[model samples]
Structure formats: structure tokens, C-alpha cells
Target: MSEIISDLNTIDKESIRIAKKYKQKNKNAAGSKEGTFTKIAFISISLIFVVLMLVVPLISVVINSLKLGLAFYIESITTEYVISAIRITLLATVIAVIVNTFFGIVASWAITRFNFKGKQILTTLIDIPFSVSPVIAGLSYIMTFGRMGWATPILDTINEALGTDIQIAFAVPGVVLATIFVTFPFVSRELIPVLNAVGTDEEQAAALMGAGGLTIFRRITFPHIKWALLYGIILCTARALGEFGAVNALSKTRGGTFTLPLEIDALYLSGSADSITASFAVSSILVIISVIVLILRNIVEYKVKK
Candidate 1:
């Protein structure tokens, strides 16, 4: 009789354990359903936001651009003024990208590789363009290089010596300068964190191995940062292309110094239906360029991750 009682007790404990496990699993299943619902809700909200803000505006621009028919749209973007604007915009973007890339590389290298006085100050100064408004930057350049400004005499002396009537304020050079000032920090900012993450140990080791500075950089540093640098260049190019306030402040000559953004503004401000349509047409060009740059940026980002 005692053996039968022991067997009964064992069977009862096993049944109780199985019941507890089933209860715990049901609780977890309930929690999992709630979690899945929350995730889906967040994703839906994000998709709605992107569709409303970005997709809608882009589609609207495209529709308006072709509203006047494809021939009219082509004519609007092919005008002499439009062509000049395109040329100037491309020129400024190219110059800004080249100059900033060089400066960014040098600045990033100095900041990452060395301990020096005013290093923090130098880093802060590099970021000035990001904090400062483009309009303010344009005005500052005007004040510095305008006829009555302090630097005017020096500029005049150089112009006289060079036998060239080169103009900065209210000219092509000024537009380029403004573009450079606004897009200055993109490359450096992109590179700094990357260099920091890479650390200096490898570079120091290569130096100890009697590798020349260039060799060390080319073999070790450049490989790591090339994608970052390309990413920065793409960003710089995009910013340069869209820059308006600074370029507008420096350049008032419509056909000579206007970029695509300025041309679009001029067309819109004319207050005619045709001009308004033309403005949208010009805007479509920028939209296309921006899409291309964005695609390139994503590709570079993917490469960086890989």
C-alpha cells in the first residue's frame, strides 16, 4: 500500500509541473502578440510620414513640371539664361568640391594624428560654416572684399600687379567663394569620426617600421577612409548644388552669375503663369541631380558598411 501511495505522489508532481509550464508559455505568447502589434504600429506611422512629406512633394513637382507639355518643359530648361545658370552651377560645384576635399583631408589629418596647441580651437573653427548662416557668410565676404572694406586695398594691389581686372564682390568668383564657405565643413566632419575610430596605433606602427609618411597613408589610412572621403565629396557636391542664400547675396547678375536655384527664384518672382511653370521645370533639374547624388550616397554608405 505504501509503494502505491509513493507512485501516486510522483504522478501528481509531474502533472503539476506540466501545468505550470503551459501557463508560462501562454503568458509569453500573449506578450509576443503585444510586441508584434507595437512594432507594426511604429512601422506604419513611419511609412505614413515619409509618404506624406517626401513622396507627395516629389510627385507634385514632377506633375507641375510637365503640366505645360513636354516640349514647353524642354524649351524652359534649354534657354540661354538657363544654360548659363547650369554652367555656373556646375563650375562652382566642381571648384568647391576639389578645394574642400583637399582642405578636409589636411584638416582631418592634422586633427587626428597630432597633439598640438589650439587643436580644439582649430576643430571648432572648421565647424563654423555649419553653425553660421549662409546669408551671413555671404555678407561677411562682401564686407571683407567690397570696395570700402579693409582688404580692398590689398586685393586692388594684387589685381594691379597681375594686370587683371579680377572681381570678387558681385561676380563669378564671389559666387564660387560663397559656395565654398557654405559647403566647407561637410568633408571634414565626415572624416573626423572615421579617423578617430580607426585610431593612430597602426599609423604609429608603420612609422616605426620606417615607412614614409605617404606610404603609410596610402597603404593604411587611405584605404580605411576612402569611402568616407567619397561620401563627403558627394555630400559637398549636393550642398554646393543647392546653395542659394550665399550665392544670391554675392551674385545679382542674372545671366552671368546665377545658379539653377537663383534662376528658379527669378522665374517664380516674375509672377506670370508661364514663368511659374518654367520655375518648376528648372526645379525638376535640381530634383534629378539630387536623386542621383542621393543614390550615390546610399551606395557609398553600403560600401562603408560592407
Candidate 2:
């Protein structure tokens, strides 16, 4: 009887142990499944947001542009005003890139390679355009160069002295200057951190070896920041192409002075279906240009990493 009782107790204890172990395993499996589901749900939400915001708008634009067929697009793009707009945009982009690139390099070098008073102030001023409204920028330019501007008389006197009808307001030079003001920070902003990260070690060593200023820059610094500089130029080009506010304020909106953005607006406001289609066509061109810039930027970044 005693042996049987002991055997029964042992069986009961073993069964309890097995049951507890099974419960623990089931709980762990349930927890793991819940975590996996949560992860999937988060990813799904993110993908949906991207599709709605970015992909949908882009697809809509492309489809609208193509609704009238390829020939129509070509026709609209080649219109006289459209051609002039493209020319103006391209010219401004080129000038902005050149001016900003030169100054960006010099300013970035000065900030990174040397220490001086008012350095912080200089940096703050350089970044002002990013914070300031483009409309305000346009107004400031107008206030300086417009008919009632303080400098208008001075400019007029100079023009008379030079025997030229040089006009800054409502002209190509004004457009170029506005573009430059907005894009002033691109290259310098891109290069500053790179210059800081690269530090002055290699530069100092080269200097110790009696490398001249230009030589050191040519061989050492330029190679380090060339890709970043290119990236900045690409950004500046994109911004210049799409700049509307400042250009609108200063431009006369004539065939000779209008930019692509202004031309698009004019087409849209004509209240004719055909003109609207033409506007879409022109807008499609800008979109294509933006895509091209993005591709080039990626290529440059890849090269930089290599």
C-alpha cells in the first residue's frame, strides 16, 4: 500500500512539470507572433503613407502630361514663349552656379581653415536665405533696384555715364542676382561639414612640406570636397530652374524675360483647355529635369563614397 501511494505521488508531480513546461512554450510562441505582426503593421503603414504622398502626386503629373500624347508635348515645349522661358531659366542657373561655386569655396575655406572674429555672424548671414521668405527676398531686391529704389538714381547715373541702357530691375541681371541670392548657401553648406570632417591634418602636412597655397588646394582640398561641391551645384541648378517667386517679382512676364515657371502660370491662367494642356506639358519638362538632377546627384554621391 505504501509503495503504491509513493508511485502515485511521483506520477502526479511529473505530469504537473510537463504541463508547466508546455504552457511556457505556448506563451513564448504567442509573444513572438504578436511582435512579428506589429512589425508588419508598422511597415505597411509607412509604405501606404509614401504611396499616398509622393507616388500618387508624381504619377498623376506624369499621366496628365501624357494624356495628350508625345507629339503634343513636343509641340508645347517648342512654343516661342516656352523656348524663351527655358533659355532664361538655363542662363540664370548657369550664372548662379558659377558665382555661388566660387564664393562657396572661398567662404567655406576661410571658415574651416582659419579662426577669426565675427565668423559665427558670417555663417549666420550665409544661412539667412534658408530661413527668410522668398517673397521677402524679392521685395528686398525690389526695394534696392526698383523705380523708387534708393539705388535706382545711382544706377541711372551710371548707365548714362556709360552710355548704356543697362537696367537691373525687370531684366536678366536681376533674375540672375535673385537666383544667386537664394542659392548662395548650397555649396558652402555642403562643403563646410566635409571640410570640418577632413580636418587640417593633411593640409598641415602638405604645408610643412612647403606646398604652396594653390598647390595644397589643388591636390588635397579639392579632391576631398569636389563631389560635395558638385552635389551643391546640382541642388542650386534645381532650385534655379524652379524659382518662381523672386523671378515673378522682378520679371516683366514678357516672352523675352519670362522663365519656365512664369510661362506655366501664364498658360494656366488663360482659361482655355488647350493652354492648360500646354501648361501641363511645360510642367512635365520641369519634372523630367528634376528627375535627371536627382539621378546625377546619386551618381556623384556614389562616386564620393568610392
Candidate 3:
């Protein structure tokens, strides 16, 4: 009992000494009053610059959208083609987010929880989408799936065998594929650091108790990264919603493959004042969706901090 008491006293003394040293270090590192003023001024200028460039444009879009009145905005979005495009965009976003979320979990888990050959290469491959151009991604799909594409023979054989004619390029499926490629990295990248920080201590202990892989993941891992997962999902959804270059490269531009962004571009290019108004209305919708995503992101961040 005395030894335990003595040990506790020693620990308390060591903690106090470390705390004092930390305080002294910070005190020495703190800048002078003029330097503090300069820092504050720099931060304020940056904030103002961001607000002017980014916030003002969004506000302008909203204002112009409302200028035509709520009725025009309503009629614009309610048009058949516009509605179809919105539906297509939503579908692509949903599918991409779901597919990427699953991939993110599996890929991040493999990268973080295991040591393997080519681990660095695997991580680099996962990040390729981030640096690759979306246009290139779209063209790659076209080259692989188009009528004269490399896989054309395989696709033709399958169709012939099944007596079914399947179209991929210039189709909804192609748009989804492009979206998936562009958004491949968001969720997994977001979760990697989180999983690394969390480490495998609890999972190892759970395994020692004979827990299965899925059981450990569900009850142990998922809860730790749920917020990060949600954050990544929101970011992926935003990117998918805004994806234009890749989808445009593969889309037929009319019939059924047009997404909301494509429709907006078409409307703007039509050169009619009403079409321009409609474009603004659609832009406003996208802006609103983006704002909602930002809000959800903040909520997730707050929860994660807690």
C-alpha cells in the first residue's frame, strides 16, 4: 500500500513538471504584439477574400434565380426534360455514393489493418482518381466499352449468347461508371487516417475472444469511423452531383442520359432569355444541395469531435 501511494506521488510530480515545461515552451514561442496583430490582419483579409469570391457568387445565383419569381423557378424545374435530368443525376449520385462507401470501408480496412506486399502500391492506386482528369477517366471508359472498344468482342459474345443487345457507352450505366471512377478516392482517403489513428488494439482483443471478422467490424470498427464515413459520403455525393466533364464525354446529351449539370449547360447554350433563367434556377437547386451537404458535414464534424 505504501509503495502504491509513493508511485502515485511520483507520477503526480512528473506530470506537474511536464506541464510547467510545456507552459514555458509555449510562453517562449508566443509572438510579440505586432506579430499577433499581423497574424490577425492576415487571417481577416483571407476571410474577406473568400467571402467575396465564393460566397458572393452563390448569393448572386440565388438572387438571380429569385428575380424571375418562384413560379418561374417552379415551372422550370417541373419541365419533363429537366425533371428527367434531375432524376438521372440523383440516381447516379446515389449509386456512386453507395458503391464508393462500400469500397472505401473495405479498402481502408485492408490498408490500415493489415500489412502486405505492395501495400504502398495499393495506396497509390487508390489515390490515382484524385490526380487523374475526369475527362481522361471518361475517355478511358469510352475506349473500353464503346462499340469498337477493346471489350466490344467480349460484350458482343455475351449479347449474342444471351440474345440481348446491351449498350454501355452513351448510356446511363456509362455515366454511373464515370462517376464511380471520379469519386473512387473520397471515402477511402477520408477513412484511412482515421482507421490508422484508431489502431487495431480493440479488434485484436475482440479476435482473441473468437469474434468473427464481420462481427468485429460491425461492433468495433464501424462505430469508430461512422462520422468519417458520413463525411466522405457527403463529399462524394457533392462531387457526383456536380460531375459534368466525365458524364458529358460519355452521355448522348439528349434522350435519357442527361444529368442536371448537362441540362443546365444545354439550357444556358440555347440563347433564349427564358432558358437562361431556367439555367439559373437549376444552378440555384445545385447550390442549395451543396449548402445542405456543407451543413451535414459540419454536423458530422461536431459529432466526431464530441
Candidate 4:
């Protein structure tokens, strides 16, 4: 028992000695790292700028939204025009998100899984909306579907033959189409890296194990990319809800087409503080929805990481 006690004492002393040596070494290394200090300083300053850019405007929006009285805010929300604007924007945002989610998933699959002629060109083409001006994007639709458009005659013939009218660049279809165009790349862009990380080997292995394509997708591919896919869709939906230029131009804004942005613009034109406050009331609703969606996104990511 005495010998065992002596052995433990020796081991404890040796461990303490090693720990002291390691601490000295780490302290010396940290003291020598001027470059590391500079890097941390730079990163801190850059982060300050980033926070200022992102958070300041959001704070301003919230403050402005609260400038009105409670009754005024309630009345603004209850107005029929404001209610319609909210509904239309919500409807367009939801439909656009649904459509874009499918496009992104399928396009990502096609782009990564297949090789075809003009594949590179087609990939570049997907980014056309990002490069082109939003106003021009809207104009292109107008020029294709308006009375003076080339397709107008084709549409006229179809209308004559079928006795049914189809409006492509107006109303709900126009809003949804414009949104889909703007948001098409998000899901594809997100899923590409995830799919690439997963590699093709898993899918191939699953296939060899007698798993069908859909089964492989469900059991293997979906789990891998689901988080990124959802993140991209949330971002796309947010952008779609706030879209102004493309929607307004394509919609013509003549026959009962008033999205939230358009409605806000109309309020500004009226030159009344109350109208602008009404607009802010509507904007506040969007801000709330965006905040909730972003929160949900973070929660999803946390669950995924865990």
C-alpha cells in the first residue's frame, strides 16, 4: 500500500511537470503571433462593417414602422386595399417558392447528373436573370405578350380558335412567372455543392443494391441536401415577396394589379404621411414574416448540425 501511494505521487508530479511545460510553450507561441493578432483585428473590424450594413437599415425600418399610433396602425392593416396587397403578395410569394423549389431540385439534378450539348451555355443561361436588369427582364415579357408583341397574333389566333383568353404577362401568372424567373437559380446553386460533396458513389451504390431511382433519391439524396435546399427556398421566397420592378412592369399595373411594393409606391405618390405610414404598416408585416422564416431556417440548420 505504501509503494502504490508512492507510485501515484510520482505519476501526478510527472503529469504536472508536463502540463507546466505545455503551458509555457503555448504562451510563447501566442506571444510570438503578431500576424495572428493582425488577422483577428482585421476580422473584427470587417465584422463591424458587415453588421452596420445589415443591421442598421433593418433597425431603421422597425423604428419607422412604430412611429404611428396603435389605432392608426390597426386602421392601416384593416383597410381593404392594404389587405388585398398583403394577400396578393403572399399568394405570389408562396406560388413562386413552390415552383422554384421544384425547378432548383430538378435543374440541379440535370446539371450535375447529365452531359449534353450546350450544357455550359445552358448553365450560363440560368444566370441570365442575375446579369440582366430587372426592369429589362420585365420589358422582355411585355414585348413578348403585349398588343404590339410578336406573340400577340399567335395569342389572337389561339383566342379565336379556343374562345378562351390566356394572359401570360399579367395578373397572377405574370407575377408568378416573374418571380420564378428571378428565383430559379437559388436552389440549384445551393444543392450543387451539397450533391458534389456527397459525390455520385452513394447513389450508384444504392442503385446496385436494387434501389430504384426514386427510392435512392428518397433514402439517400434527399437527406444529404435537404437542409441546403430548404435554406435556398427560404431565401428565394423572401426575394420573391419583395420583388417590385419585374412584377410591376410585367403586370402593367392598369387593371387591378397591386402587389405590396406597387401598393407602397402608390402610397408614396399620394404625398400623405398617413399613406406612407400605411405602406410602412404593410412593410412591417413582410418584415415580421421574413424574421420568422429566417428564424425557422436557423432552427432547421441547428437541428441538421446536431
Task: Give me the candidate number with maximum TM-score.
Answer: 1
Q: Which stretches in model 2 have alpha-carbon errors above 4 Å?
A: 1-32, 302-306
- Which model scores highest in lDDT? 1
Model 4 alpha-carbon drift over 4 Å, by segment: 1-52, 300-306
Candidate order by decreasing TM-score: 1, 2, 3, 4
TM-scores across all candidates? 0.93, 0.88, 0.86, 0.81
- Cα lDDT, all candidates: 0.95, 0.90, 0.92, 0.80
Greater-lDDT candidate between 2 and 3: 3
For residues 110-223, what per-residue lDDT tens digits would candidate 2 score against the true structure?
Answer: 999999999999999999989888777777888999988999999999999999888888888888888888888988999999899999999999999999999999999999
Q: Is candidate 3 or candidate 4 better by TM-score?
A: 3
Off by over 4 Å in 3: 1-40
Judge candidate 3 against the unseen true structure and give its global Cα lDDT, from 0 to 1.
0.92
> Where does the lowest 10-residue lDDT sum fall in candidate 4?
250-259
Instruction: Kindly list the per-residue Cα lDDT of model 3 for residues 55-81, writing each as its tens digit.
Output: 999999888877779999999988988
lDDT of 1 by residue, 1-306 (tens): 999999999999999999999999999999999999999999999999999999999888889999999999999999999999999999999999999999999999999999999999999999999999899999998998886668888989998999988889889999999999999999999999999999999999999999998999899999999999999999999999999999988899999999999999999999999999999999999999899998999999999878
